[model samples]
Target: MADATPYEDSTTPSPTVLSQDITLNWKTKATVRLYRPAVIPPKKKLPLIIYLHGGDFVLYSASTVIYHNFCNDIAAAFPAIVISVEYRLAPENRLPAAYFDGLNAVLWAQNQSLGIGGQDPWLEYADFTKTYLLGSSAGANIAYHVALQLLDYDLRPVKIKGLLMNQAFFGGLTRTQSEKNLIEDAYVPLYVNDVLWSLALPTYMNRDHEYCNPISGGSYMGRVKGLPKVYIKGDYGDPLVDRSILLAQYLQSCKVPVYYRFNQGGYHGIELQNTSAAQQLYNDMTWFVNDVYQNLNSQDLSHHHASY
Candidate 1:
């Protein structure tokens, strides 16, 4: 599996968005690519989007062209400040390693938002209080884990207002209906999914472990409380579809604000898969972001309910 993205040079502005990369951790050389509208309104701060690209968990980096193009679209469409992170991958780092990198990335954003560390010029246009996290496929799985883990931190001024998961990659020892039904899926086959888990999960852990299957954990509820509003997108034709629905149901059951859409005839990361699918994905994302922003700006979202 691989997770990554980057298209234009740091110095180049693609018609709408301008992007640049910054190293987050010097020792590990972990980096994050930042994107914002080519032209910004003076004194208008935009929402911050921390995104993770997917490749199951074993492949890719922020330089992956497909993911990079997607980020460009997101930054321009939302007219937001987007940060695509580069993390330690599996087969070498494994499970919690990526999760930890995710936490570090969030914290780094917190510091930037608070001006604890020196701030970047682009971040000056970011409304740190309206932060969001987005991830696709295995990156979504990482996003989910990161959101939960963040509940344990104190990132004031860096509120996570929403989470967006696109065809989140999750599995278990027991086959879900969608997993069995889509075993021979064209986009991501069952065999390849199994191999990804084998290489990405902890050496001694099986598919039933908490990282692979969140519902399998008895105390997951305690860990998942107070998560930001969640927007989950599942592709009916993808092998991970069941897990996507299952996650939404679980989070809703926990009373976490949830909004989900399960579209027919699509595969994992469909947004990055093709032009049409990408348009729909962004449209869905736009709707969700707009709703969340409107609610946050005008009223309290603490009472937000599940909307499928």
Candidate 2:
């Protein structure tokens, strides 16, 4: 059952930024907040970043103050149009509900790209060909599932060039060393983490379910091989750090293009709370996005040469 009381901070005032909220599905109240740069170049189409906010899948919304601030910074830094998805949370909607909302967000983007959806001024300057999925913690989990869902169909005019996962939220039935040794901090306490998982995961599934633990082999392992280029950043002190390492190793074993970075002396979701760390991660993400675009161009050039 869903928690009747909503989080107090969920509706906190957001920093002054150029953003607008739109409803993707009126029935389910699924919506997304679109953020744009303070200044837009004439007739310039920038890369699109579809962001998912982290809240252990049971708390927070796209309008949450921390998430809104983070998206604003990202939009200004990367000069990219960001669409922060407001998916239905768990307990109320459950596991696959969030996943479906994510897919709907992507489909909405596709429609906007084609000019079939309702008018959105920001979409006019959105470069769908370079769209990227950006998420933090539980949001990253949603991004991963959305990427997998897209594999079954063609999303023309809207290409998912890469995935940027920061402090991804994943769990297993067995505890890792970090989980056992690390003391619960302000960001995420061990007991709270367990409770959140119990509330978010499917009623019939455990921590090892593929939705919660991507590395837990089932159908997930088979689908991982063809995923888009991925960039993962994790904190050494985070309990989920080992999960990131394991995921990186698995992607490598499957020959998937992946880049993983571990930040020492940090904790889960530190980037949002710390200014310097947030700037550095933003810089890293900017570089990664540029590199992905460069690689895509090179591939195009090679195909052109082959055709000649």
Identify the leading candidate in terms of lDDT. Answer: 1
lDDT of 2 at 288: 80
Cα-based lDDT for every prediction: 0.81, 0.80
Candidate 2, residue 111: lDDT:
87
- What range of 10 consecutive residues in model 2 has the weakest lDDT sum? 299-308
Query: What would the TM-score be for candidate 2 when compared with the true structure?
Result: 0.88
TM-scores for all predictions: 0.90, 0.88
lDDT of 1 by residue, 1-308 (tens): 01224345656545688778887766787888889888998999898999988999999987699988889999988768998888889898998999988888899888887776688878899998888899998889999889988888899989998999988988889998888887898888999989999999999899999899988885556877688788887777787888877777777777777776677777776777588878777877777776743222222233423221
lDDT of 1 at 220: 58
- The regions of model 2 sitting more than 4 angstroms off are 1-17, 292-308
Task: Compare the candidates by TM-score and give the number of the best one.
Answer: 1
lDDT, model 1, position 111: 88
